[model samples]
Target: MARVDVRLGRRVRDRRAVPLAISLALGLTVAALPVWATAHPAAARIAATTHPSATEPVGEPGGGVPTADPTDTGPVPTEAPTTTAPPPEATPPAGTTEPAPTTTAPQEPAPTTAAPTTGAPVPSPSVPPVRPSAPAPSPPAPPAGVHVTTDDVTLTAAYWNAPSTVATLRVTVTNTGATPARIRLAYTLPAGLTDAGTGGCAGAGGGEHRCGEWTSAPGARFSTLLRVRVSGDAWRRMPLSGSVRVTATAPGAPGPATDDEGFAVLFPPGPPVPGITLDAEEVSFDIGGGSSGLAVRLGNSGRVDAEGRIEVVLPAGVTVPAPPPGCAPAGTDRTRCSLGTVAAGRTAELRLPVSATPEAQLRAPLSGAVLGQLDPRGGRARQLRMSFRITAAAALATPMVSPPAPTGSQGVLAAGTPSVGDGRGGSARRTAILLIAVSTLLVVFALALATISLRRRLAVPSAGPPASPKP
Candidate 1:
């Protein structure tokens, strides 16, 4: 009976083994399902703690949903990574710095397992520590010295010093500079000097045109007017009180002592109470063809006779014909036409023809003015000024020298004579005076005193002797 029972138990065990084998295989298949699904995004997670061996099966069929390929490019599930980075760059010199090197590569980090490789280089941060030191400063300047001073002025002239003639202002300057310096002396024509500043006395006469002399210096030049405001110290002693503008530079020098010597200036004196007037405001004429004549007419136009020179500035192409025989040119600009002297309330003409010189006649503007007098010493100048232009009247026809006209007597006529009795009357009067003088002296006996006075001093001049005004 025991033998039969053992056989039966073996048969039963064999039958149970079939179900167990199937269940074991099923478990492995279920485990593999999770592993495959985990590889895909669309699956339930398997516990990471589960051992790989646990999923191994003794036996089972080999299938579930098909597994995805390993090389698929779909996004993978992952945690945000840990990384090391460089710091921010420091500010650099604006417009002044060079660019960094570009081809260089970042170096590989040092290896924990081994020494770092030389494949990539690490760029050092561009931060500069303490900036370079600053630059140095500049030095100081020098100092100034003490100032010098000027002196008072005096004047001397023909009109003022001459016996019969009117005054001719001669300005004299007395300066006080230890070092040589110029003393600028100015003379303002007392407002009512003349109607025309430069008339007879203003111009030339008796071989002396420019005749004013300074106190000491003889032939000194006049400076141009300076329009700058006078310094406070200088303004205190202005001649005419108000503000005066002049063109003259008084140079200064530094010295211990003041100089009391300066220059003297000779110029036409100012007009009388009112002023001097011209025959016309300006003298202008045109020279075209034929006879072109320029007459500078004058009128004492005031109370006294005006003495001054008239100037006509012609274009370079034109000139004045030389005077015919008899009349000699009085002054500068030889071509200058002349009126020996124009009397008060009288008229004069200076004829300069357009054909004065043989040249082309052109239509052009004459740009120049007439300055009656040329003395602008220190203060403002009372210059008789005028400007004008001439338009050509006709075309040139012929060029020839024309003969000058003849003149008549200069003074009044006698009762019997038509123009003038030859000046024999003066000689007759002098002879009568000599006869009377001899008769009176013969009776009075004063002739001896006269002879003695003449013999006493014939050479040395008196203390107040006049200084002649000629070079």
Candidate 2:
């Protein structure tokens, strides 16, 4: 009985040992699954590939394993959890035949997480990038070629006559540049002067005279003349002065070029006599011994006919190198000119050549005198004082030349006219008046003495007769 019981205990111990070994093998396989999946990724991919969806759990339906929730906010698995079946010798039933080997498509690589960015996000390909706009272009510059110039700009006004006086303005326009140009000239007369509407110049109002446009070829010149009438009241304002401007223009040319010229009509104060008036225009001379003319004008302002000689006394530091026709030098600084019988309302002009010495001052008051008479009777002579200034040599371009006097009444003294003595005729007339007064006084004293003697003789004769009678 003891032997039999020992044998039965040994059998029971063996059966219990089999179950312990099986539990140990299952624990080992479950722990080693993660390592096998990491090492053999291709073989372990059967769970993800064969499953209907990658998120499905690796267990049978209704098993204790949980189903993945699509709406769950849990952390996503970086790598798909790979699961594989246990080895055939460990988990398959003894009767079940091994499943035929299956084929699977290759798996694509998992997308990687991009690095954290700190700068602005890049624009999408569908939208275009914004670019800076370009700037506007500048205007073109003017051409350098076409140009116009002006020369010989002169303004002439009659110095003698005031009423019915005409002033002529002449200018020469030239295209000095290489290219031809279009030029337009306009004249602006000073105040109190009006356009005469002559010389093909039309009045554009406002004392402005406009000459129609003219085309000038290269190196060619065009001359324009404008005559304006001077009112008598305007002439009364002696030394009336102003400037004339001419503007030139052309196509593709720069701003217009202007030519400005200054002009003046000068006159001096004269004696109260209404028959004749005297005037002297301003003179200019170069500092280095240039010569200019002194224009002396004599006008007959009265309705009566008259004539006389004119004498000019120059200031110190000035000399007359050459005297005008019908004029003679009376002294170093004096010139005597004669004018024939001046008819009513007539005038004459005499231009004397004058030169300035090195000592002559510029812009200084140069005082002098002019002696003459309009009355035929000699005693009516009067002396007119005048003054002027000397300017830069370029102040005046050309000396003024006046129209000649009428025939038989020229500025030259005709034959048979009494000579006008040295300018001291006024003193001589005073001396003759004193002599006549002395002679009249002497005659009156003689008459008074004779009358007294006659009275005394008569009284004495009566007394002598009475004494004889008494004797």
Candidate that would win on TM-score: 2
Candidate 2, residues 186-247, lDDT tens digits: the string is: 55666667877543345665666554333334434334445667665553333344445544
Tens-digit lDDT track of model 1 for 45-87? 1212121221233122443211111222333212111111112
Question: How accurate locally, in lDDT, is each candidate?
Answer: 0.28, 0.46
- Steric collisions counted per model: 41, 0
Looking at model 1, residue 313 earns an lDDT score of 45
Model 1 residue runs over 4 Å out of place are: 1-274, 279-288, 306-308, 324-334, 356-360, 367-383, 393-471
TM-score of each: 0.21, 0.31
lDDT for position 285 in model 2: 69
Instruction: List ranges where model 2 is wrong by over 4 Å.
Output: 1-162, 199-206, 266-282, 285-471
Query: Which candidate has the highest lDDT of all?
Result: 2
What C-alpha lDDT does candidate 1 achieve relative to the native structure?
Answer: 0.28
